[model samples]
Target: MLEVKNLYKEFNNRPILKDISFTLKDGEIMTIVGPSGAGKTTLLRIIAGLETKDSGEILIDSQAYDSGKVGVVFQDYNLFPNLNVLQNITLAPTMVLKESKEEANKKAYELLNRLQMNGREKQYPYELSGGQKQRVAIARALAMKPRILCYDEPTSALDPNLRKEVEKMILGLKKSGLTQLIITHDLQFAENVADQMLKVQPLSEG
Candidate 1:
């Protein structure tokens, strides 16, 4: 289980997220939805340890949160233009975990196959379609074997058909017992995949 209590954040002393709290159970999908500037992305960043929270606590399965346990897929997919799909997926594992390159490559290939990206391992990001790029991003995250995966605006760049495909993929991951946290403005997409929905509002300056 992932539990967040009284999470708070601000930029330049202007509040972004205030008193945010929620709990997401194991193997379930939680979607956070709100209008732009509601700090939805910030909240995900905080959880992923890309940004700091001013107060409160984040715990995973009764232990304190560690960024290593969280992996985030940014809205843009964030694939390296210079790296081929295989390199992109294997980079973190080899560098961070200090795993042998061969070991990382083996796991990367498995992840690619699972994500339906097998033959494209040698292709660069520029050669991939939007949906394919998203798959690569997901593969990259999954290669890390994170306990929790967070997505920011996952369907923002896709058409309705692609959105449905992503919904199916997320649901498939649930069956494999991976906890997911998604931040998106598309309520319909959120409704389709989320086991729980969280609505957030922007804080008022006044």
Candidate 2:
């Protein structure tokens, strides 16, 4: 559903992404694997439209969705701290999608249910466990209903065992037929859930 070509980005004359290009097919889960400073997150941001590429093209469903078109699950779980789970999840639907309050709330509730946060709708981000908070972040993104979902190492903070819970939620999204690109250092998670892997190739010496 998405394609990118010849993507290049630079910081202070140093390249962050060099000739990065790929496609995310419909209903397929693709994982971007690389070490730190490999431009994984920058690639996600550029594709999401949050950041601009110095040179490249991105197509979403035959049109351009920018990096902003990709729904993000960042490691920090950027929730509005004061907004409860349901409110946080419904914000985009109401503001961006222009749905009515009742409509947004209905969709929010259903999403929370699917994410297993049904009765916790009234809870604030600070009130939840780390996993619960990440779940809310997932629900918030899914409620946006983006055709492409991008995750930036969503399990970075959890204990290894707790990491599995968040991984399960992400894996489940893949099973539900969502098109996704996950940037991760955790190869185990990638091997378990990704349909294909995009490992960052080495930069050649001058």
Candidate 3:
């Protein structure tokens, strides 16, 4: 389970997220929706340890938030431009987790196959389509063995058809019992995938 309490954030003395609180149970998908600049991504970043929160408490599975236990898939799919898909997925596991090359490669190959990205191991980020890149990004995150998976604007770069494919992929993850947190402006996608949807309203600077 994930618990966020009294979350607050600001930039340059201006409030962004104010007193945001929520709880996400295991095997559930929660989507945070709001307009751009509403700090939806910031909330995810804070949870992912990419950014710090001004004030809040985040607990994952009864423990404090840890980068190793959380995985984030950014909107741009942030794969290394120079690395092939397999290398990109295995980089973190080998570096951070200190897994051996053989072990990391085995896990990466299995994840790629599960994500239906088996044949693209040797392909560079530039060669893959948008959806394929997203899948690779997801596979990289999964390689981390994170207890919680978060996505920022997952479908913003895809066309309608590709969006549906990604949607199915997310649903498949949910069925496989992964806890997920998604930040998106795509209402229909949220409605289709979210077990619960929360709107992030911009804080008023009265």
Which scores higher on lDDT, 1 or 2? 1
Off by over 4 Å in 2: 201-206
138-200 per-residue lDDT for model 1 (tens digits): 989988889999999999998877888999999988998999999999999999999999999
lDDT of 2 by residue, 1-206 (tens): 88888888887777888888888899998999988878888888888777888998888988855544678888888999979898999988899889999998998888888888889999889999878888888889988888988888876867789777866877777778889888889998888778888887545433
Candidate that beats the other on TM-score, 2 or 3, i.e. the better one:
3
lDDT of 2 at 131: 81
What TM-score does each of the candidates earn?
Answer: 0.97, 0.93, 0.97
| Tens-digit per-residue lDDT, 144-189, candidate 3 | 9999899999999888878889889999999999999999999999
Q: Give the backbone clash total of model 2.
A: 5
Query: What lDDT would candidate 3 get against the real structure?
Result: 0.92
Instruction: Give residue 121's lDDT in candidate 3 (0 to 100).
Output: 90
Candidate 2 vs candidate 3: the lDDT winner is 3
Order candidates by lDDT, high to low.
1, 3, 2
RMSD of 1: 1.0
Compared with the true structure, model 2 gives a TM-score of 0.93
